[model samples]
Target: MKQGIHPDYHKVVFQDSSTGYKFMSSSTKGSDETIEWEDGNTYPLIRVEISSDSHPFYTGKQKFTQADGAVDRFNKKYGLSNN
Candidate 1:
């Protein structure tokens, strides 16, 4: 058990970088950024690349790659044809 050697665990805001969704949680992660939450209080801000808001699996927007012509892209890259 140590005292000063331990990092502080406190409330922080995790913002989805792509979607701008904010969520409150506690962590040992340190940040120099700050954000004002809906509760009218400021918390340490952490930017994340992805979260449940924009994830393909969670949003059911998962593309099988066939629906968006991604397969065609694959074919083009490998010198193949859709036909």
Candidate 2:
């Protein structure tokens, strides 16, 4: 509640780098980049790797990862014959 003790809280644009999804929210984080939002106002831009739009969990999708040689090891360990 004290002045000059807290970081500046203002409108910020969080963008998903992979999907190019952008949203506006209030944040105290600072950025040198600026973006003109749909509201015709400029806001600090923050780039994020993942967001709800492209996230597998949020989108109810599963991400497939290759096990490489580990797959054979796992199968052998559990005696799971790969027929």
Candidate 3:
């Protein structure tokens, strides 16, 4: 518990630049831009490139690649078979 030594933590609005999705959360970061939140209050606006809304993983658009194991790769490289 220090006095005035920590950065100012306040509520800010984070907006996804690609999807225009916005959500409010607490952050130590500050911004000159402001936005009106759904709560009818004005807060600092922070723009982000990606969020849950536009993220491939969150949106279930991510590609899953199955990588071959070492043994499988070795077997494939040569003419070796399990039998």
Candidate 4:
């Protein structure tokens, strides 16, 4: 709704190589670690340890982690210690 400030739209390559591109699992055998890209194609290969495949939020398996000092800090800030 406001002018003079906005995010710049940049060109991003989603899937560069569909022919020679393959999703190789790190825990599988005969998987080539090196990806041989085509010539004259300037595409970046980013390494990801985990994606949405193993994410807890997408898989509906998220767990709540309870911290020690979290409850104490919340009670002190909200004056819940009087009760």
Give TM-scores for every candidate, taking all chains together and pairing residue i with residue i.
Answer: 0.66, 0.69, 0.81, 0.29
lDDT of 4 by residue, 14-83 (tens): 2224232234332312222334344443333434545555557866899876775788889988888755
Of candidates 4 and 1, the better by lDDT: 1
**Best-matching candidate per TM-score:** 3
Evaluate model 4: give its lDDT.
0.47
**Which candidate number has the best lDDT?**
3
Model 1 ranges with Cα > 4 A deviation: 1-7, 64-83
**Residues 25-75, candidate 3, lDDT per residue (tens digit)?**
999999999998888999999999999999999999998766667668889
Ranking by lDDT: 3, 2, 1, 4
Scored by lDDT, model 3 comes in at 0.94
Model 2: weakest 10-residue lDDT segment is 62-71
Error of 3 at 74 (Å): 5.6
Candidate 4 residue spans exceeding 4 A from truth = 1-46, 65-73, 76-83
TM-score result, candidate 4: 0.29
- Compared with the true structure, model 2 gives a TM-score of 0.69
**lDDT (tens digit, per residue) of candidate 2 on 10-79:** 8899999999999988999979999999989888999999999999989889866778768888988999
For residues 19-53, write the lDDT of model 1, one tens digit per residue: 99989999999689998899999899999999999
Model 2 residue 54 lDDT score: 90
How many clashes (backbone N, Cα, C below 3 Å) per candidate? Answer: 0, 0, 0, 0
Give Cα-based local distance difference scores for all models: 0.90, 0.91, 0.94, 0.47
9, model 4: CA deviation in Å? Answer: 12
